[model samples]
Target: MFSDKSCVNATLISGTKETCSFFIFEAAIHWAEEGHRVIYIAPKALQSPPLTHHDRSNPSTEAFKLMRFMYLPNYETLVEQLVDLHSFASLPNVLLVDDLDNYIEDPGVKDKREVHIARLCAILLDTMNACAVILKQNVHICVSISSECEKIYQLYFDKLWKIEEEDDGNIVKVKQVAACNAANKTYEYRKYGSENIILKQILYSQN
Candidate 1:
């Protein structure tokens, strides 16, 4: 699902808010189930707990325990968390940030929005790189940003993914818009039952 480069592995996920949230939670669950620690950062708390494909009769408590959630309600808080990431005794295998555009478009930052956003991006990328180097391991950062802010943030990411849901609401499409080190591809997923989503097929690929 992500690269293993021993540096900053940043991915930008662009989509509607609902689609982005769904994908991020699914990805986090996937990593957690694989016995990897996952850290989820967001400006606000999730409306509901993540639902996975695991059977209700035998829930996976271990996976849930491996996940950590942080609420950084403002830009300053987010920056502080990133800057102090390396000081923590343990690091997660995957870091998920949701709705980053909200922080970048903070109401308090009324002037030089571009400059502020660029600096924030720099902090995020540089912090991740430094952590990777100090720990001697890959740092995977997945950020979900609104389409309007995609142009500003995409340049800092190694890969770009765009997601869309069909009008019927039963189908979702994920397209790899760009990748500096991987092939571009597209995939379709269909909602299964009430809460489960299953990958239907790979739509296409391009080098």
Candidate 2:
């Protein structure tokens, strides 16, 4: 509907880790259908794409493409090649980095991995787009990433949103966190249902 990925002023997502299936992939397809450029990447581990070079234009839509999706580079190869964040940040308008934990994820590394990965995350956040989503399956790691953005947003981004889980049981709802102007001035936070997450006053001041 909207071509402006930059309009993605904020995000609203569920708290716990959720598998982003074809349904979610279709959501992205719809975006591209409307002529929105996209850059999709899985986590370093899952980042092992089915394949980077394909003759097919629309792989997700094709059944054969589905099979193709299963033939991407392995972890060892990805680690060696997926180094330039600039190569990523500069691609298409909509970029999907799966396994937020893996994008910056180093299964057996130190902060050195985070230092590089976090820098990339910061770049994506700083980029002006309608929508930039980073998927993390690890709540602890997701929180760690959110914590970094929360602080970085303070000094850089005009606004920031931390999307997380609220209630793990009963029913699931997407949590929305935001930067608000209030007497308290503390960063405002709120949780909303998936339906309530449409582009609206999703961001508000707690104070």
Reference-based lDDT, each prediction? 0.76, 0.35
Top candidate on TM-score is 1
- With a 3 Å backbone cut-off (N, CA, C), the pairs that clash in candidate 1 are none
lDDT of each residue in 66-173, candidate 1, tens digit only? 889999998878888988887777777678899888888888776587787788878877776766776677777898976554466666777888887794767878
**What tens-digit string does per-residue lDDT give for candidate 2 at 21-135?**
2123433455556555544444423332222211225544433221111112333433443344224533344444444444455555445753655565555544433233332
Q: Give the TM-score comparing model 2 with the true structure, all chains together.
A: 0.44
State, as a TM-score between 0 and 1, how close model 1 is to the true structure. Answer: 0.83
- Where is model 2 more than 4 Å wrong at Cα? 1-14, 19-27, 44-91, 112-114, 122-170, 182-206
Measured on C-alpha atoms, candidate 2 has an lDDT of 0.35
